[model samples]
Target: MMTGLHLVIARNNYVKKLMGLSIFQVSVIMLYVSMGKVHGGTAPVYVMGENGEPDLGVVYSSPVPHVLMLTAIVVGVATMALGLAIVVRIKETYGTIEDDEVIEKDRQEEEALADR
Candidate 1:
């Protein structure tokens, strides 16, 4: 049936949109994490030299990236949660979760309401 075909197309579109959004979120997190690392920073270990003095000249790796990454992770989770909420709403408003079905149903409802 035409409705079935429409549902298939709508579902595909929704899936594609979801995939794109996911990819975008992942890319943003990766970029933020990558930017957080210092170029030549040494590890944070305090090693004693042969002379019996602690080598403190070595710059420890920057922790800014790690901190930012944590923030990004939180943000990413929030975004995903919000996105899923929207999907749930869309599914609820429309009898079918398919894009085309929702549109068609909305159209029919509008027409019926208008006629009344």
Candidate 2:
């Protein structure tokens, strides 16, 4: 039942639909971040040993996933920001965020145009 409700909510055509998508995107990013972390590994920061040499003995976790997720997070934030901006514009123009209403409004406009 809960899953069905979420599907309905996600399918709605309101402006700011990006807000819902952003939640899923963030969750995926978190999953990637969790997958990137190692149980016994240290951070990727560079450190010099007492001998003034880079320590290579310690087991370092893979950096690829961490780096990739970081990039994805940045892109996701930018994408969300853009979606919000578009939604704001949509509300300002249509005075409503609902998709059904917007489509109806357009249909009426088209009919009025056809009548002319």
Specify the highest-lDDT model's number.
2
Tens digit per residue, CA lDDT, model 1, 2-113 = 3334443444455445655666666666777677655445455555657876555544455777777788778877877787778788877774556677788889999999
Give per-model CA RMSD: 8.0, 4.9
**Model 2 segments beyond 4 Å from truth?**
1-16, 38-60
Cα lDDT tens digits, model 2, 7-71, are 43766565335656666677777777778756546655745668986566664566888789889
Compute each candidate's TM-score over C-alphas: 0.59, 0.69
**Per-residue error at 21 for model 2, in Å?**
0.8
How many steric overlaps are in each model, in order?
0, 0
Taking all chains together, the TM-score of candidate 2 against the true structure is 0.69
Q: Per-residue error at 109 for model 2, in Å? A: 1.0
* Model 2: residue 74 alpha-carbon error in angstroms: 1.3
